[model samples]
Target chain A: MERETILSVRDLDVKFSLRGRKLNALRGVSLDLYKGESLAIVGESGSGKSVFVKTFMGLLDANGWIDGGSITYKGEDLTKYTTEKQWLGIRGKEIAMVLQDPMTSLNPLKTIGAQIIEAIELHQNLHGEAARKEMLSVLTDVGITEPERRAKQYPHEFSGGMRQRVVIAIAVACRPQVLICDEPTTALDVTIQAQILHLIRDLKEKYNLTTVYITHDLGVVANVADRIAVMYAGDIVEIGLCEEVFYEPKHPYTWALLSSLPQLGVKGEPLYSIHGTPPNLFYEVKGDAFAPRNPQALKIDFVKRPPYFDVSPTHKARTWLLDPRAPKIDPPEAVRKLATEGVKGYA
Target chain B: MPENENREVLLSVRDMSVCFGKGKRIFKAVNNVSFDIFKGETFGLVGESGSGKTTIGRAIIRINPTTSGDVIFKGQKINGKISKELDRRVTREIQMIFQDPMASLNERAKVDYIVSEGLYSGERISEEERKRRVEKALQEVGLLPEFASRFPHEFSGGQRQRIGVARALIMQPDFIIADEPISALDVSIRAQVLNLLSELQKERGLTYLFISHDLSVMRFICDRIAVIHKGVLVELAETEKLFAHPLHPYTRALLSAIPLPDPVREKNKVLEVYDPTQHDYSVDKPSWVEIEEGHMVWGNEKELNRYRDMLKA
Candidate 1:
């Protein structure tokens, strides 16, 4: 059965001009988010992952300008909406977001209850007692105990993990069709991080909402995402089912990302890290942005950017190495072992 | 374990405890934590926030006065009130690299000034000689020599960390406490910095108290592992042994929580939470006991009995 696409982004381009230098933050990036499924956008910082998703929530900085492309939500072009007033209706109601830092995202002055109730009241005509009731229930639903007491407490009173849970509660308050989480658990501890990941997954199921989870950790993507979108230098280099992407990654960059992750049970062997920093987005470039750092770069890779070559019906990667004419290069030995031993049952 | 041979005992933290405030209202930040770092070996301290890992590091360097116990480096005790002589010796022998490189370093200072600040207290050296030393330190950390002229903001996060390392190395300290040094770096750059630290430790014979929450990282660089939780050192063992057969409940839980790269195995592997009450330690005061050679576990008979009883349920 074909799933309904909740959000479809096409040829999306976001640019910034600083000190008379134009930088392309997102260059012709496109992907789809289906209802009731998670699409994880994975990449290192400065890979333009955040910038591409920020467009959905209308959270781009003042310097950022959408140069081209359209973001369609439920067949409506969100890019066409120019004002915050129009976006406010959808921002927290239809398309809610959970930012990286819960401390910064929440207002310290306001009580959690007040803030949550305010969120609920904005979309609904509930007032006073009724709004408070809804807010407490939402808090309880997100796994916070003693919802009444917790709702009255300020953001500072809660731990990093609890505050993030509160933020998730507020995001899910309106039953938004889409929830965008931007590195939601990056600052949290591993145990707390696992709980939060489970919470997000549970909430996604309960609400039957489409989720766009953006993070640098491939370990996170492997656990939570239904499909994976590998981004590099403001472009979607690869996109596939989670199993296919993890086990049979065709792109050298994806292979590098997979291999770079530190694994348990892999004793003594040094974890492989992708060499060289991500390229500066300021300069206009021909060929691939990843070619210079790619160990298996060919003459064609240097001359022009590779088109999206299909590996399977659902999996594709933008790499010259994917070309039928290009010579096939195997992944590093350690990575091969990691895929077979560590990543069993994925493919 | 091969690196354990020829390892000189550089720093030894014995029964160190640090308490904040006073009287009955006092909070024990570091409760009887103990470990040893041999010369030219990297000893990792792994724990989550509020685990008192940082307090242990600071106490060893005498940044914070220990409430009780001692931090012995070489043979001299380094804790409590610092005298002028002790301060000079401790500062010269030990250095620190903080988590946030940009915030730890002076933003306004040039790279050379930051690196040479430690040498300012030494006998007056020629400006040319100082510049040479600064450039040499930068080169050692894999940064370009010309970076000396640039400010902190000009460099990337990874470069700034290299600068921080260079600053510490310029002091030529025998032991260095790196508190989550690479936690702030990008995933791709983290390996570079780790490799750089590993190589520098080999070339310079520097001992490191490498502290981090990430177990995968700890496994790579550390020779021995110390697991702390809620102001107590729960487990200490050789890095490989600790990873292979983690005895303590917390250590086992910590090992289980490390996310594997493999998608399928990650789903199947259920990480058990660390329950401290499962071990017997109620008969005597809580302290680390040597279960085997170089391996320590916290709790005495009284607490251990309680834990054993709980496990029986």
Candidate 2:
């Protein structure tokens, strides 16, 4: 069956201006977010994973603007949305975002019930008793117990995990077709993180909502992602099915990321680390942005950017090594072990 | 298992307890926690938030006052009251690496001053000596000497964490208490910091007390792991033994919560939720028992016997 793309981004370019300097945060990025499928965007900090998704909902800062390209969602170009009024028509009713920190995202003074009710009344078009009923139902849906009593409590009265659940409740109250979770579990504990991931997955199944996860932790990505997109220096270096990306990765950056995990690492030995930092976005990037950090970079990689080469119908990578003339380089030992042994090697 | 008698006990916390407030609102942050950190070994203390893992780390560093019990370092008692010479020695020998790189560092101070801050407390050293030491420390952590002139705000999260490590390393301490050192770092950068820590340990024979909520990370780095819940330890065992045969229910739950980077296993995995109320310790009065060669568990007689059976199976 051919899957329908709910949101299609074609060659999107997002730029930010800081102190008279221009930063190419998202450079020629393209992605197709499928319906009811969870796509995880995995990258290091400053890799523009957040910037790429921010353009989807028109949430970029005042200093930032779309440089070029199109974000076509249901036949509408979101890049053309210049005013807050235009964005309001698409923001919560069409798409909603759960930000990284739950503490800062919520209002301290407002009751948790009032916040969810506000989102419910404004977006869902239900008011008074109906909105209040919906707020309680949403609270229960997020696994919060004693919804009636807890809803009246302030944000300071809740724990970190409970506050996150309230935040999730508010986001889901809008009944959006798509939900974007930007490092939702980064500030949470491991147990709480697992519960939240399960909750999100359950919510996705219940609502048939397309979910997009932005995280640096591959462990979290593996648990929830149906498909994975590896971003590097504001570019999608690799995109594939979760199994394909984990087992048969073709990009050096992906290999390094998988190899560096402590689960795959052998004790008393140094894990494969990507030396140096990510490339600065202020200067114009030539060729591959990851070329400087990549040890086995082909000469051509430094001169020109490699186009996406299809490995399989579902897998593609942007690297010169995938080209026909490039030399066949073996992946790191750890990544290769993962390919052959699967999870058992780590287990 | 090797004999622990011959091994040197670098720092030992005997029946230590830390309490906050008083008169109807007393809260025991660390309740009668006892453990010995051997020389040149990574001892992991794993727990969820509000479990007193940070409290224990603070108590050892003298940031928090211990309500009772002794914190013996080498041969002398370091906690509570001590001689001025002994206090100075303890300060010079023990150091700490904090969790959040962004919050731990002083925003206005240069890397040079931050790294050499410990040296400024004790003796009046020459400016050139302090500068040389700062450069050497930065170089040790794989940062360029020129980075010492820059402020903390100019660096990345990973770079800022390396500065934290450099600050701890400049003290030349025998022991370092790293409280969630890599929790705030990126995944790739975590590998860098972990490798750097192990490398430094091998080079200088430094002991570490690694505290974190993540069990998978503890599995990679720690020699022995202790599971604490609500300020009370439930289990202590070798890393492999803990993974192979987790006795306590809380330990099993914690291990089950670790998110593996394998989709097949992770998706099919069943989460074990721990309920502390399951333990009927009111009558039995649970006590710490060494169930195996080096493994320990906090349980009464009945629970201990069942744990033994679980190990056998």
Candidate 3:
């Protein structure tokens, strides 16, 4: 398959100024988001997964700034676009973001119709009736029944699932080329989550928009993502196709996350939990940030950082254990079943 | 789980209903829900957000006021039947672990004082004994003794959740209502907290009314599960039985919706949507019926017969 790269991010370094100290939120993060494909960034909280995606939209906090690297979108360097006015031209029309909480994302006071129509008007040249027409169709497009009635209603009148639909409608109003969902279904129930993921996938195909999902739920990532990137301590530890990451995962952090899944354990048995929490991003990370908690950490892992080792043409992982001289280790027993299932295409 | 006749029922909620507002604006959050938490077993209550799972958990611990129906603790009808004086002393045996550890724990108060708050209200104890109990609770939750001097704000989200667990364990309560304990935690930390809860149950013989929306987590921890939808009991059975043979449409829909960790399986999976309108309950009001020997499901005549056939097939 010939892959079309919609967005190329190279050695992106994002830092935040904290009380006179500099905290690097995203460190040398690099990846390509193929057109019309969903790439999920899976990691724990504060792993810089959100920061890595937020750079694409220029939505970083006031104290934060892009320390280095380039975000090339349609031949434009987004990192160099300093002014909010410059961002206005490409923000919603070219790139849109779907946040986790719909309550904050959607306007509570305004009618759903008014919010969607306003977004449509901002990006498109559609007038009163045309904009309103587009807004209602978008609401319907996102799988909300009775688009006319739903548009007239406020956010409180809608259920949690319906509210998320409204948020999606607003994001896709102008039909952006790229849709970055930051934990879009984390707020929704399991059943509603499936509904929303299906809707997003359908819309992604319809619009030919590239999808980037930032989430902690591995289940959601597996269901929605085409490619997977494992982020830890602001570093992209692993990146590959969804099957490649899940079936033949290389990083120890990925193994730890997979083994920690409660479903992997039997009744009355202890779960495989990682030893410690993520290191504080306040201080500069020395060597591998995951070494202190990683069970298979080598002596050199504490002294020097590990570079990316190619597992396959599509898959790559960063770990000292992947080095040629390092001792071979298999993924834990709890996770080996998952790999086999992925290989066989079913359990 | 042991035999129904052999095992003791720690807490039994009969027709427990929790209503919000009144008159024209009235809404029944939990409608005539009934279940039993057996001794030394994890009793899981699962449903979507508005399904009133949290409301039922609150009612059991007496945090939420009950409008009607009876909540029988041991052999006594405790809900709305007990006087204020008896309520405090009797309800002390029931403790609760909240979803958000940050919001539940006091930011200003030290860990030791926050944990001993329940003890301060209960039977009087010596200051030295109180210190010993607090230390023991912290240690049991896998925190160091020095952490007792620190405040809630000083700890991370996962560590603060451990503090919340420690606070509940300090009471040495018979039953604990774990309301979405692991849902608010990170994926990497969820297993550790879940294991701690399981250990506490085994070590202390504590019965847990584990309330969560995550089905897989429920399957791993709970011995028995009750599926609730729109404030109504849909199905109640043993964990393995319920997962394998989901009699209710809502339960089946929920099961199908959960995206498994395996990618190929997830990609091939198809979810069936459950619509309540498809069910015609006009002829007969849906009531809890024993579909099999132990599995119970709420349905009218049409659904009841269909569920039995589905179970067989």
What TM-score against the true fold does each predicted structure earn?
0.94, 0.98, 0.97
True contacts kept of each: 0.48, 0.68, 0.78
* Poorly placed runs, candidate 3 (over 4 Å): A341-347, B83-85
Residue-wise C-alpha lDDT for candidate 2, range B49-139, written one tens digit per residue: 8999999999998999999999999978999988899888888899999999999999989888899999988888999999999999999
True contacts kept of 3: 0.78
Instruction: Please identify which of the two predictions, 2 or 3, would achieve the higher DockQ against the true structure.
Output: 2
- lDDT comparing candidate 3 with the true structure: 0.88
**Which tens-of-lDDT digit does each residue in A217-327 have in candidate 3?**
888998999899999999999999999998888888999988888767767898888988798888888888899998788898899988999998889999888899998
The C-alpha RMSD in Å for every predicted model, in order, reads 2.9, 1.4, 1.8
Best by lDDT: 2
- Give the lDDT of residue A271 in candidate 3: 88
The runs of at least 3 residues in candidate 1 whose Cα sits more than 4 Å from the true structure, single-residue gaps closed, are: A264-271, A343-347, B2-7, B275-285, B302-313
Q: In candidate 1, how many Å is residue A100 off?
A: 1.1
For residues A1-347, write the lDDT of model 2, one tens digit per residue. Answer: 58999999989888999999999999999999899999999999889999899998888888999999999999999998888899998898889999889999999999999999999999999999999999999999999999999999999999998999999899899999999999999988888898999999999999888999999988899899999999999999999999999999999999999998888888788877889888889998999888999999999888999999999999999999999999999999999888777553221
